[model samples]
Target: MADRDWSIETLHDDYRQALRIDAVHYDSNTDLQRIRVLENARFGRFMTLDGVVQTTEGDEFIYHEMMTHVPLLAHGHATRVLIIGGGDGGIAREVLRHPSVTHVTMVEIDAGVVEFCKEHLPSLSAGAFDDPRLNLVIADGAAFMRESDAEFDVIIVDSTDPIGPGEVLFTDTFYGHAQRRLRPGGILVTQNGVPFMQGDELTNTMRAFKALFGDATCYLSTIPTYAGGPMAMGWGTDGDARHVSLETLQTRYAASGLACRYYTPEVHKAAFALPGYVARLMP
Candidate 1:
């Protein structure tokens, strides 16, 4: 491929952060939306969905580890997992790291994202799709949760920012369905965008979650590629929210025996230590 300049901007009404790519590995518009696989000097291989940078080679572990390990470890023992919209497979890979996760039913709206990422951005999936535990379902996540009777011990909403197709997943209607699908003591986690830049996103999610679960909160993790202070992951469950202790996390981390670059037992506790500014955004 010839060298070409590719400029992509984050998806926000007012945010101006953008990335200039050195090379384009793949670019196409699927039935769902536009997708781009680009190589950058700083972030290396990364993919953007509908112009928003989803994940990159440099800092994906931060997002994936925090997203997966937090709720899984907090839940203590999750044999069945449901992942919504993480076509990149990073979330699934991390979920399967836990020996207790016997099955993971991943529902991605766009099959194109999965195929393209598998072919060009192979590192993101990291062979998680091939794992026998992964039951990859291509369908609208909200519809799947509403129609299916299957229950999950942990339902992870690894969705993109609430836009386009993702808009539905953030609504209260979908969240209610997700809550109903969870087994007793199960937890629901979501990708609530950067609180600094997308405060409304966090606030709205917390409102809906709090209404359904009564125990809703947000956690923080810094992903450089997201170009914000810290990204927020929405947490909700009917279970005890105060159960996440340092000792518990440490015990779970040691038992898993999986080495991770970003998720540490200590960091797990710290992620929920939201700053006052971010806390103000919560309901």
Candidate 2:
């Protein structure tokens, strides 16, 4: 991928690759507006409900791996993992990358997204749905946290932004629930949103995260389809902050771990080094 800088502006590298062929309006489904799937010459085909490009066919691994592997490796031994709001099965694919990870329980609100992925996105999901290591549950992520007695080594909140169906997932209540759902040593991570475009919301979300988790950190990456060129991730822990060492990730995440275009070790470590504006939000 050669960095490509991964921006939202460039012509060939930008998100304006291909066009949608057909769109349907279904009310029995979701209130998320402008929901439609697209077929692209470059990106192959993808399902995008409510105008939010759920997962692009071309670069699903970039987002999914960064979201899943960073925390899993950061925690050092993430044998048991939980995913909230990632119905596409991409995060689950990355979670299973760790041989130590015995199982993953995916709590998703939209069962339709799963069906869509199973039907169209097998390449991106890489059969994570059929893996014995996964337990797919159709339920609200926040509600699942409230009732879950399971203790996970890591919890990755692969949620969309705070609005429409994905609103409650960003609340402090959900963060508190996530804390309870984790073991004492468990680490929590989430996609925080675009820093450049949704700046205030990003800061506020970090604040909500800080209130519940003992330690919290925010980071950024470039995801073209999102609001701005830069997207973000939040790292929180039930216990104190722990640094991910070189030795810890030597086995699982290497210089060129798996097939990834965007997330590199340098990018992985540098993502957490926030700017002055974003850093002020932390404790």
Candidate 3:
């Protein structure tokens, strides 16, 4: 089995463990359009059924921030937000950072993941686990999108890799459905995943998004957990806002007093800078 194949080969890296504690994924498969959860421990390593450690130190935020913030900032007037997956609650936590945002509806298929996050990883989720502004609905995001008439200002697809619960969210039909769920001038952002394992996956996703939305872009952010490499994202909307200048954003996005290790408007602008392989696929 591929899980055993991966198990035998996956080397231990400091990236997946903490404090003599480690996690491992014993087995994983999607059924009924949901990623099944399983947990395992090996040689002091703790792993999830998804074959990755469930840890507070995980770099899920770096990708979630870049995926959600860049587009929300670009719009500069987003109020209502929708996040698919992210039952871990990081995206919902970040979405509230924008003063412009009034509410966020997070639709995730796995109630177990949501429960675990609230119980165990409050620090990583930053107490937004039970924020009044957040509505955490445990349901399939695609079905919710189909029945959803309430349009959002921005929608962030914060799913796992395509193989598991998120396969539908990656398809052209889902993109089409997302476009329909958005307001006339709404933006969509997605965690398109590691650019290394699947060459040109970013570009291909961008191509599909472009066909659905007039404006589309792919961006990169360094995430330490995913395959020991950087992660990529896809963004699309009808119109582009004049970018918020770095100097202006410093004061605008809460306390110019604090600093972010990875996100700067300058970084946000540069994130769109793709390598030769990804850039060539753009129309």
What TM-score fits each model? 0.96, 0.84, 0.80
Candidate 2 Cα misplacement greater than 4 A, ranges = 1-34, 239-242, 251-259, 280-283
- The 0-to-1 C-alpha lDDT of every candidate, in the order given, reads 0.89, 0.71, 0.68
Q: Would you give me the overall lDDT of model 2? A: 0.71
Return model 1's CA RMSD, one decimal: 2.1
Q: How should the candidates be ordered by TM-score, best one leading?
A: 1, 2, 3
Best-performing candidate as measured by lDDT: 1
Residue-by-residue lDDT tens digits, candidate 1, 1-283: 3223655574666766656688889989987798999888888988988778888988998999999999999999889999999999999999998999999999999989999989998988889999999999999999998999999999999998888899999899999999999999999999998899899999999999889986889889999988768999999898984367889888888999979998898888888889999999988
* lDDT accuracy of residue 249 in candidate 2: 54
Model 3 lDDT tens row, 188-239: 9888766655445566677788788877877888865556466778888887
The TM-score leader among the candidates is 1
Model 2 Cα displacement at 105 (Å)?
A: 0.4
List pairs with backbone clashes in candidate 3. 22-45, 22-46, 23-45, 23-46, 23-47, 24-46, 24-47, 38-49
TM-score of 1: 0.96
